[model samples]
Target chain A: MSRSTRIMMSVIYWAFVVYVFVPLILMIMMGFKDSKFIGFPIKSWTFDWYLAVFSDTEVLTVFGYSTAIALLSTVVSLFVGTWIAVLLADRKFFGRAVMFGLMVLPALVPGIISAIAFRIYARVLGIEPGMFAIIWSHAVHNVPFVCLVVMARLSTLPKSQREAAQDLGADPLVTFVRITLPYLRPALIGASVFCMLLSFDDFVRSFFLGGYQPTLPVLIFAKLRSGMSPEINAISTVVLILTAFLGIWAERSMRRMKKET
Target chain B: MTSDAPTQGAAAGTAAAAGPRSLWSSLARSQPYQKFVDVLFASQRRSFLILLLPPIIWVLSQHLGPIVQMVSVSFTDAYPRPPGQEAKFTFDNYLLFFREPVYMMPFMRTLIYAVVLTFTTLIIVYPVAYFLARHVKRENRMALLLLLLIPFWVGEIVRTFAIMILLGNTGAVNLILKSLGLIDRPIPFMYTGFSVSVGIIYLTALYMLMPLYSALEKIPASYTEAAADLGAGAWTRFRRVTLPLTYEGIGSGATLVFLISTGYYGTPVLLGGPNTTVFAETIAGFFHVAGDKWPTGAAFACIMFLASLALTGAFLSGMNRLSKGGRK
Candidate 1:
């Protein structure tokens, strides 16, 4: 709290902001660069890279595929993960701790290891790895995030409304449908957006599981491996902007919900 | 049937007495589905079990099942089978991991880098997280945190790619330094442990910051005031009150950073030179580049997984002890 300490703290704070934004700014600038090489001192500006990204059929197809998978996986995770989260929040069963650990275990495990497992599982099941496998992998990986958010929201909910509903002879299902589910709306929205972003941005799992039909990140990684291009920069910038927008929106809504609560 | 009717009538009467137009009462009016709902839910335990069963089964079978499969695969000779030959279970894959210094060195190096990255991120992120928690206005806090997190939402590969652009020989960093007469030569920042660490720290900084910020924010102001009233100096109050309260945050943050850094593949591969091989890249190589070496890959991954599990256990137990000590 000393003057020097205060000055030093503010400097550190701004330094972090600069550290985070500088690279991002460079990336955005690269997207606009006419040259393929990403470097300082822009020689010219062009929208050709952006246009190329849109014109390329493979990139467009992969983008569409990634979007579809992300949406489906998010929806699936929200449905199933909400149930698990609610159960964890509502109950104190004997195996509760174990259940919680198991729920979060997938998220904790390294994605490459999961990818390896998924690859083996696919081979064993005689199921060819494709969009289905990738979607399933993403949904499973994302369940923990949904569960965490929903559980946090559930903990904040007062027990009285739920108890009162049950006290009036409402079944647990009805109480959940009418009372508890509504209470979890903001958390559900926030968590689903988060899960969607995670699934969309996931690379390693998609790389292994996306055998024939690669997701956007898988394609991007593959493209980058070959070498960098302004086109890749364009696609990355688009993805970045989309995710950042969703993230900020989710945070805003969650903050608003917090204030209301 | 007669007893059921009487009970139903009593329930309706009680519901009506409570409030006929209430949300619960409205739901209760759906009498036709009530029996079906009761049969399905029956008990809280039954309902919870029914609800939990699907996701649990999916996670276990689809997610954990693969990991379990990896462990089994590592035990078997998953590659180099002759025509009409059955692969047998053996410890050869794991043995290779320990015997080969190429594998063992990277594993050790990964742990070292993970520790270094965790501590580096902790040191850099702590002050910022503290400032945001203690100084930022309530309305601005969430927005600022969101800004910090926005870069992370861009994906790790993209972020690392950006870092590569920033630190490449002809990158902005070098160009700026050169223009400022800071250096005559472009620093080879792209292919080094320094770059790898910087990239990893940048990618995972928010993970550390958010937890630390929340933990610091949760510290009640009254405790600090009480320390001040006791004639404690700023440094003394911070060391005793602030540090202990936020120690949990540091533990969680460091654990997260370490876990992610150890498992991370892209940063080390893209930015790091030959000397900076990480455990994940090695695993990736085994699976991707080395033909018919998946068993070895599985074994290496299993070793890494076990280490991660141990780290998690230590952190959790330490956390438990910390919470217990705090109570006293």
Candidate 2:
């Protein structure tokens, strides 16, 4: 890079950094404003909105619901996803391409269409819509992603490892527990984190699944619907920080895996 | 056309060698030291099926079903019927949409909006993505990438509404400008196409950055280094080497942005003025608010679904084609 080009890139980069941070800074500033609607440009600061945001049961529960659903979806999807990867790796199966396509289907579909299908599907099954169904939908949506990432790891595993384990008197169960699971730890964790973040950050799937209860993103969407308010800003501030931390965690894990390979 | 298929022959070979016991029994076995090998192989197939069935079923119904239904809806009169007519399927909806000024104009508007948003986001995200990919040190690289993507992790509604606050008439933007005597009254920033585009850009720009950044990062340092060693200019190397290498990322990013922006609702609804009706909002209006005419909304949705499917296919095949990374 030449000095002039380097200077130009640096200037543009800093400007972009400003573009990224300023809205958020304004959001935080607006959060402390003594106002109900997000009017922007603070006259004076107050923590009343923050208090209202935390103290309001309805607002707080949405956050709680999203967190719970995200966690459960992550764990359940990880298990199912891992199982699929194991099967995919160890077996040659009929209609594998079809299965892989089906697995990634939900993501490829538009949200509005998916929402209607869920609405109908839940009705025909006579299953009530709520947290359980919401979690199920999220898990189903994310598992294929988990499978794809983990399958990358699974394919690279030397056949010798499994064969060696079996020859040394280790049963399939023992070999999987002792060798496969440990070896797959990084990809598994990567898949898990990615799935969790996805579940939490999602809006569309949750909208369909949410009936009596609203997930965090849906709740935020609802709030955005009527009008913009300062309370939403405070909420975004917290989310931005948490997700940033999670992204860092993912980046490190990926780098570590790359080095090992 | 799709992913690599699993072959049954592989299963047969593994099964013949692994031996057999019940997969469930392997789980319940007291001694996990090495004994339960046969059972693990026995249930692996079934467990994998069980694992994938729920989500696939969900997608088929939730995804594929709606698309089919939506296309069907596009044909019906939906709510207002012709004299002596019943709720029947016809090409009228498509014809009406194309012919009627009200619906036809908005569709064009929506298309322009999508195209503009795509190019604008691409232009804006490129340098930031570039810096993260090539210029940032490895140790600091991850941190910078996180910095770019962190806004997205917060969730779209929150981020969109945050912009609403900042750009609101009495919002911080005006407040700051006023405090600094840069303006006399709050600017009419909210509920306009500008505000809507800004919000959409913020929400979807992250999609562009991450993929482009991933592509950029994958370019070996040696390519540029060797170019520099040969006295090639920075711009020359970037145009010749870096850009070509990241075509997959570019394709994916553009596809993602295009798909996401087309289906967009939140930003446009919150920030778009009365004249700012998007195709998505029209779909929402057709079903939810427009007399419960599920069919018409379904039709509009089907168009979107079809467009996205085509776009996604184009993107993937393009990625596959460019997978050689311009080496050839």
Candidate 3:
């Protein structure tokens, strides 16, 4: 590469990084700011907001709901997604293409529309909107994502291993458990983690379907819309860190899976 | 889990060999377990259905059924659901949607914003995606890409709030400008059209990057090398080979970004001023203040959904033709 070209590339690279990270850094910084107001200039540093987040019952309750729903949906999505993905990867059947499209449709469409559709369904069915409604709605949106991730990983596995196991007098289920399952372990774990993060971060579906008590994102949206608070920044910083940690963990596992295969 | 299977099998085999009358041998020869295994792998259809039924049923009940219900509600005279009145079928909701400039304007604006945001994000992320896909060292590329994408996983609400703080009256941007004497007063960045647009771009720009990178990365280097050997310059090689090869990806990325951005509710509501109303916010508004106007909201959602589908179909087909031409 020419000197000018190399220089230009480096500039663009750093600029992109800064553009993405600056706001995140700023958000974290503001959480530590003692003042209620948000801005660039830092005054006295304090951990009051973080402390307040721990004691805030409303935030804690909403967070508890978010965790419970995310966990429920992620576990549900993992099994369903793995089963669907295994079928998609291992089998050749009629209407496979159409089934694949239908399976992926929920992810392809916008979440707001899903929220609208589910809300309407709730109304028509006279189902009271709450945790039950929100968990299932989140599942609808997240199962496709889990399926897609696991399918990608499944596609990478060698087909010969299962055949070899079966030729060795192993039953089909034994072949799968002995050969395919280990290969898919990383993908399954990664998919579950991804689904967990997705469910935790989801706001659109939860916003509409959550009845009296809302999830964390919904509560945060309400708080942000009504007004700004240092407390929100503190909570958001914590959420951001948690998500980043899980994301990196998922990324590492996916990388290790790739390397292993 | 499978890693333990071999060792366990070997151990069981040794135990059975060492003691023919052992419990392990008996269990291995158990008739009920044998039958259960045979039944479990009985038929592919049975297994597929058993495995798939849970998710399929959940998706059908939660997603497809509701979508059908929502579409049906859009066409019914369900608005102003009086205390004792039943809804009848009518074309009035669709008519009002098309005829009213009030509803029509936001619909059009939403499309226009989607297009502009799609292109804007494409232009900004394309080079970065290309650099990551092609220029970065192979060993480090995945880590770097993950680093870039981690911010996106931070969630939309948090990202928007970050922008709100960055562009607020007393935000970092204004504070910096004021400190440098660039402006005596803070710019009205928050609650403005510019802020909403920028926020939407910030929230979704990475989505475009991932697809574009995957698409660009899939283009064989050999194709570019062949073009280069044919006396093509760098720019010519890129234009004739790289760009054409990735047109499908570009279209997919643009479509993804457009669809996601256009349906944005929180970003516009939080960052946009009163003047800036998107279709999503409008739909939410109808539901918020007036419980009886659900049909109107449902109609708006149906229109948005159809419009989005139409746009994606057109874009995909157009790109298919373009990519085919490039191939030839």
Task: Pick the lDDT winner.
Answer: 1
Task: Tell how far residue B229 is off in model 3, in angstroms.
Answer: 3.5
Q: Considering only N, C-alpha and C atoms within 3 Å, which residue pairs clash in candidate 3?
A: none
lDDT of each: 0.83, 0.72, 0.83
Model 2: residues >4 Å from true position, as ranges? A88-95, A124-129, A170-174, A227-229, B1-96, B176-183, B225-232, B290-292, B311-328
**DockQ list for all candidates:** 0.62, 0.42, 0.62
Task: List the lowest-lDDT window of 10 residues for candidate 2 chain B.
Answer: B33-42
Residue lDDT tens for model 1, B221-252 = 89999999999999999878888788788888
Q: In model 3, which regions exceed 4 Å deviation?
A: A167-171, B1-13, B16-59, B79-86
Scanning candidate 3 chain A in windows of ten residues, the lowest lDDT window is A1-10
Total clashing pairs for each candidate: 0, 12, 0
**What is the full ranking by lDDT, best candidate first?**
1, 3, 2
Q: Which stretches of candidate 1 lie over 4 Å from their true place?
A: A167-169, B1-35, B42-48, B79-87, B289-291, B315-328
Candidate 3: chain B TM-score equals: 0.86
